[model samples]
Target chain A: MIRADETESTIVPRIEVGERLEAGFEWFEDTFDSAINWVGSTVAYISDGLAEILAIPDALILTVILAAIAWLVRNWKLALGTVGLMLFIITVDQWNEALETLALVAVAAAIALIIAIPLGVLAAKSQIASRIIRPVMDLMQTMPALVWLIPALAMFSLGMTAGIFATLIFALPPGVRFTELAIRQVDAEVVEAGHAFGSTPAQILFRVQLPLAAKTIMAGVNQVIMLALSMAVFAGFVGAGGLGTEVVRAISQLNLALGFDAGLSVVMLAIYLDRVTAGIGGGEGVLAKLLRRRKSAPVQTEETAEDKAATGSPTT
Target chain B: MTDTASNNVAPAVSVQNAYKAFGRRPQTIVKRLKEGATRDELKSQGMAAVIDASFDVAPGEIFVVMGLSGSGKSTLIRTLNGIQPPTDGTVKIFGQDITNVSPRQLRSIRREKIAMVFQHFALMPHRTVGQNAAYALEVRGISRSDREKKAEEALNMVGLAGYGGSFPHELSGGMRQRVGLARALAAETDLMLMDEAFSALDPLIRKEMQDQLLELQQQLGKTIVFITHDLNEAMRLGNRIAMMRDGRIVQIGTTEQILNDPANDYVAQFIQEVDRTRVLTAGEIMEPPVAVLGAGQGPRAAHRLMREHQTSALCVVDQTRHLQGVVYEDDVAAAVAAGAEGLTGLLRQMPATLPGTLLAELIGAASQHAAGLAVVDDHGRLHGVIPRVTLLNALADTSAEGAVRTILEEAPA
Candidate 1:
């Protein structure tokens, strides 16, 4: 008997999926040449501007500012850790490159969120939209991340613009998926209550659904930022400058020291962004606790004074 | 029973042959239902939540839709507010047809004419109790200060005055439901829909909430459609209750009528465990006074009337039937022996109750006197009398069959 694999290969005609994809890419480039060029130049300008702004502050002062934010949002331990990691990057002369990577990741993630959130909301509200979007999102996520660079390179050529475009696509699915999940997970009775009170669809979305889904949506935002950071490093393969360039160069040349230093800098940056974003998402950061205490302080004092007055004497 | 067409005054809510089915093809299911298909026969096609329900709620009347889970009472209430428009038939609120209205008009009608209290409290977790209470008014585009003022007043009405600043998570379950009630009340709508509003609370809290709702109803006089699975709650709060089973309304009647004359086995079975003593009123069981003595009648006449009626005592009343006092036969005989002229000398004070007093409360008063309790109107006119034996029979007639038999055997023609 013939083997099952051999029989399958002989019976089915091989489809030229790879060739079709290449032709599709070429057609898109030819059709949207001007639009692609405009987007590329705009993204490049914004990334360059952000890099220059991030570079203006002295490295030490910038590190201090970041550490201070970590302390306020997180804790002293995280702040100290951030200071150590950032200082090591500065010592290794990777601070400027790290800032550039930061700029690239920031721009890509912001744009991804701007597109994904509304799509997610639409998907959550309408069954047809959800059905259509879910399969597309699945395809986007499951497709090899590197495959996106091929079309991105053809459309924008080489540079940070191409890097950002690839990174944007790579980071998009989670934002959409998580947002849809968050909104859909809101209690049905709560939504019914909104409708019962005569709230319009828009009002219910903004006032009831969004507020209740805030923490979950913020978790989606954290995932987007993390994905953007990882993809920005991958974008370095297509001439996107920053720590990614160093990493690519070190990898090609097989220089162990350069590779190790660049890789560590990327790790430090990822940890900082992840922790800060997680604190914002989880809602029990040190700063929040302090603020809540401060808000309740006056009420406690007023209550005590009222109690004394009500008892026919003001002891204090 | 429905006065939608017959009455000159428009009902607060009028539902006509409303049918709601849940599935991809609700219309097909509704059509099948109309063609005489039973709910079980069409079960695979769609779940018929409500089938051909029709009712009219008069203004200021508490119309209760009561059923067990999966009986479509909740679905029926939703049709009134246009939250879930029925698959077939029309719904009107104060004479305006809502079934065919646009979304904007439906929302406007909800904002202007209707407010709703939910089962699970449904208070927003992110908002403070005050903000939750103000939600309905905020949706109506009321000014912040005005809505806040109204919300505070509503909270005060629900006895949650100082808890407004607290978040819903900080409040107890009962308090959260109070905030839910305050939210509906602050809307100031003429019509309110409550879907099992007290079902989630503890027994004690549920009873308190029910009493508060009744008190609020007395003050506000809002037309309310209350949905509940608990028959006792329906009897306690509803002016008229519609009993539902398997997506169909089985019967609609007052508590007395339903208890004495159930339309079907389902309603009888449904109300099997209802505490009849709590549900029935003294007026329902009271009989016309056997032999009423005029205040101008002498003690001898009272004694003679008591003997003629075979009663131990006679109620002395004015010419206009205003209850003066009860004259016992022994006292009348004593007065007669002492040569007293008027019943005034022999008349003794008797406990009087309003017609609406529940028999549970009258049992104690009924037990205290040989003459039993007097059922009186607001102006102290004697409507009827509940003798001790009648009170005991009414209390013992807890089962629906026994109640019907007792009413038939004992009720005067």
Candidate 2:
């Protein structure tokens, strides 16, 4: 009887595969440890910078971010909860590390959006490019995000670079997929109208498609930020430092309070960003107007090709 | 319509053998590449969206392209602005071949001399109404103040004066459409492409807008290529109508020529549901006036006058000769039989609401009541009676055109 290992041996022969897997894991673990430490340190610096710029106490930073978000979302209750979460993180005396984690997540998410949106647009407009890049995106989205650490460690050799690279891969898919989908899903009638006005392809894209897709692309950005937060915590396994590094340190030392505080801070930051961005996407509608638009805009269209390639959009 | 429009010279648009296609043919691109092919072969794969469509839009005339959905009116319209290029033939705007022109030239032509109003309006959701309207001028890189001024002027022209600051969602459908018109006008074009622009509006609003557009065209003297599926709208708006089917122009002619002397069964079917006289103006059939009666003429006097003229009715008038109700002989005879002597006649006594009354309503009202009904005024004074022959003739003419209209009216649109 043929075993699954026999089938795999044909693909990659001549090596003791189990040994190779162990060796790869060892390499990943070593790189992961140092990457987490570096990321943690960078996070600390960013947090300090944010506190100074905003003129808030380092401990109050998360609370302020969440409170601002809640205000924007018009959810005073949620805003108060964000304040409570911030105060809780401060009680654990990990406020500085928490601010660092927030900054890392913010920068990673921004970089992801900047790269992904343009790529997504390019994918939408070109059939050849879309066909080539779609399978790669599928693999990125489907493979366990831990796989990113393997490649990231090999290339970056452990530090903030490895942490950022890993966070970018995990958080990047939504931005590309959503931006592509939004642009492609622009109303055909509107596009034709643009054409009839003698708008060049670029003009139609930037003026008509992008503006229409703003909400969708923003949704992608929101997902990237959330995913980046999740990945940032996991980056604790690497040497790159952040609150993730503190959590790792606490786990190693068996300090439950520190680990729990770090974890909850991450959740608070995620909630704050998610709510704020979502409120923006929801638009400046009266409750009645929101209900009407929500009921109607979705009937507008569900997906574009960008979503189809990245699979971030369920409709695609 | 064509002759009058073109006699002045320099047609606004002319399409000669234009064709468009989508998708590939029998051989796929990969297969062709393996077999070693060229660009022209790859282009032939697409299905023809528009095929050999030829027509000229004369200056200051409303040229309507009428078709059922997917008849390539859309593709044809897009070609005028150089959005979609024809596989063969040339599209000339003011005798310049727009098909092979540079992208910059196309954009310039669109900015300066051509504007389009789409079916869905296409007003930007993110922008305010003024912003959407000013977008064309902005694309031409106009000054902010200059563009705003142009947009404001256009808004007032389209009757959307204060809607400038509002977003598209804030405006009603009619108001949004007005914004669309303003956007087109802001382009300051000599030709306007209206692709079913009014089809989405409510019926009353559609009529009002159509009338407003006609009034605008008359005043502005701009050429228009209007595409629609509604035959009634075509009849109402088109100076010269081009009926398309399956990406081909089936017939092209004036409304009267298409109706009265239908080129084919399709053209005949189109006007079959129309009230013939309504499609016609009073100017079409008016003859030189010959008084059938003198100043002292009574009902009896009008009767002899009509007989001599071989007409059943004669329009009554004062010494100033203002139009009054038409007097019918039978109405006079009936009033005489009723002992209401020295009175109005049949057509005079019967009520008339001008020649524009609906055929159905007139038929229903005059169905069996033939007492030579008094054609009264707001004061209920007799003017003239409606001769049965005149009503019958009008009905026959309308029902003939109305055959298509009845078929459409019963449709599931």
Candidate with the greatest DockQ versus the true structure? 1
Candidate 2 lDDT, tens digit per residue, B139-234? Answer: 777877777778877877887765555578978888789889988988888999998999999988998898789878878888999999988888
Taking all chains together, each candidate's TM-score versus the true structure is 0.91, 0.75
Q: How many residue pairs of model 1 clash at the backbone?
A: 0
lDDT of 2 at B147: 77
The regions of model 2 sitting more than 4 angstroms off are A1-58, A69-75, A200-202, A250-257, A285-316, B1-8, B25-46, B275-278, B284-394, B397-413
Candidate 1, clashing residue pairs?
none
Q: Candidate 1 — which residues are off by over 4 angstroms?
A: A1-8, A75-77, A285-316, B1-8, B288-298, B304-310, B316-325, B342-349, B354-356, B376-384, B398-413
**Candidate 1 lDDT score at position B237:** 88
What is the docking quality class of candidate 1?
A: acceptable
The residue-by-residue lDDT of candidate 1 on B1-413, one tens digit each, is: 32223566678888899999999899999999999999999888889999999988888888889999999999999999988899999999999999998999999998888999999988898776667888898899997667767887787799876565667888889989999999999999999999999999999999899989988998999999999999999988888889999999999888877887789878777667888888777777889886899988898787778777788888888999999989887888889899988766677888999977788888777777899888899899998998898888776645534435445777788
| lDDT of candidates 1 onward, in order | 0.86, 0.71
Instruction: State which candidate has the highest TM-score.
Output: 1
